[model samples]
Target: MVQFLNENGEFAVASKEHEIYAQFIRDLRESDFLKFYRDMARIRRFDNEATALQRQGQMGLWVPAVGQEGAQIGSGHAVGPNDNIFPSYREHGVAITHGVDLMSIIKMFRGVNHGGWNPYEKKFHLYAIVLGAQTLHAAGYAMGVNFEGKVATGNPEIDEAVITYFGDGATAEGDISEALLMAATTNAPLVFFCQNNQWAISSAVETQTKVPLYRRGEGFGVPGIRVDGNDVLACYAVTKKHMDDARNGLGPYLIEALTYRIGAHTTSDDPSKYRDAEQVAYWQARDPIIRFEKFLRSQGIGQDFFDEVQAAGDQLAAEIRETTFALPEPELELIFDHVYSEPHPLIEEQRAWLRGFEESLGGHTPTDDGENKVDYGGSR
Candidate 1:
């Protein structure tokens, strides 16, 4: 029982968790402890409120990050500004930590666009809905690093690494396997993170594999380690070490975070249909947000601080509400923009035809269901 951070905000890993790690935490400074607590609280607030917006119909659909805030926020803070991040769809916390606009995430859930921010701008890629696709992208990017001669240059400040996050279900995908193989062979500067939220759709972990998912990386010649995902300190410490290792040309590492989803898989999926009520109840007691808050209070933080944190959380929720309602619908012409750098003749021709049809109807095509259908004649 290595108690990394005690109930009171002090830094010390409990001896029960790991003998060596206890000493490691005793060496950690107070500033890092406070940062972990702050990041966890904010990420939790963002997800909790985002879910409410979904139910209120303020957004089309939302994937609640519910229980994994510790895992996300912890690892999110371990990177240098120069490092890159690749995330699967439920990584709103990482986006927030990276300074992505919360309102842009709202617009995505509202079905207004794919993503609101540019990957190049933040060095954080867009969320990949296709399971395990970003892992390959991460591996390829690492390969590019090798080509650029970034590996093992021995300058911790100058060299960089990559991190890709996927779920337990994705560990079973061919893309994940291929990515691991590529990274292992090339010794690419990458980190593979599997959140292991357990259930993949209606199927449970028993249905996926008997042994742990992190072990999958070991067979591929990449070292794998497990962390208590709900423990923000554990997540941060492990990821930070691995990231630093990668920066030092240690190649790749895989981390499997042991945690529960604590909510439905997404807005559209109903966990109640497949999971037992008692199981959900058991995990809810171990909620990451609540657990971390308790840890904070135990560290001598008073109700006043707690009250202030809650107030900040409330303000964040209200601000998102105001922002969501204020977003204007984008023009239809935006669909034709950004497809290509150079205009294609076919695209131009289609745009002209649509413009002519709209002008024929006096610049605005009526979408009234009751009106007779308008058939703009084309070439015979």
Candidate 2:
């Protein structure tokens, strides 16, 4: 069923098997393919650097979206400027492509704030860390689009849609089930994109399901399809088509992207405890960034293009390291600022007390030990 992409990283149309992607790819030119290729490269570089920064004691924690770039970039392109995206924490690719400040994402890893930006203001929502909970918000948001007249206005340019991402482990949650039921019944203009990176933390895909996750959506009466989660082109083409479908009021579709999670679930995890060494080595050989770059070069993208993207990626990584390390630690007073938009009298009194306490301590300030410093201004 995953035959759309083979070991050689070549793609083709297999009848009724990846037909949607097969048809979609025929419409894309080499230039379109390069967009996905470039995104995958940049985000993977960012992921690696973030991991390094965390190990070097610069970040609070890091979530490596290393092998999941194809899933992230493919679905991300389906979104328009007016559309909204709800992402899981590992969606660095989606966030970066949507004009999210690179340093803003860095701040989250730097532990300066829960989320670095407002979702509505950015057109991309904050990353959801609650297992599979974003599905419901995505459904409600899609329903809101309908209520707001954002879908099917006889003008595709004005219409909007959503692509919500989760993982294989998230499928078991009631929120995911309820989201599917609501989307199926309401025909919400959303795409439920599952990046089945073959693991839910420590659990493997086989344990997560007896049948494929895409097929599960069929029970809800939505059209579901599987993609080569590593095949960036397939991911991009199928997702763009489905998002266009939602914008056209064709209703929700499910995409179960099949890929391997090459890194531990997060920096806190150790894959060697649960996964076989050979299995990890095999997927590493088939890494999405390397495979996509190979396909892009095969399609006539030059070594210069590769070199240019590589240079840009390296710069972005270094910038992430420097900027994240330099991000201001939240002012001691800011902890009380956003807690309530309208401050309570008691809260204000407590803030006053804390301020007085700081003043009494000689304006107690962190003295940088040359290695650790905190920046208060957001995402510098």
Per model, state how many residue pairs clash: 13, 6
List, residue by residue over 271-331, the lDDT tens digit for candidate 1. 9899998988877776666777777677666788677777888888888888888888866
lDDT of 2 by residue, 95-149 (tens): 8779888677778877888785978787888888897799999999999988888
Error of 1 at 46 (Å): 1.9
Highest TM-score against the true fold, candidate:
2
TM-score of each: 0.89, 0.91
For candidate 2, the per-residue lDDT at 244 reads 86
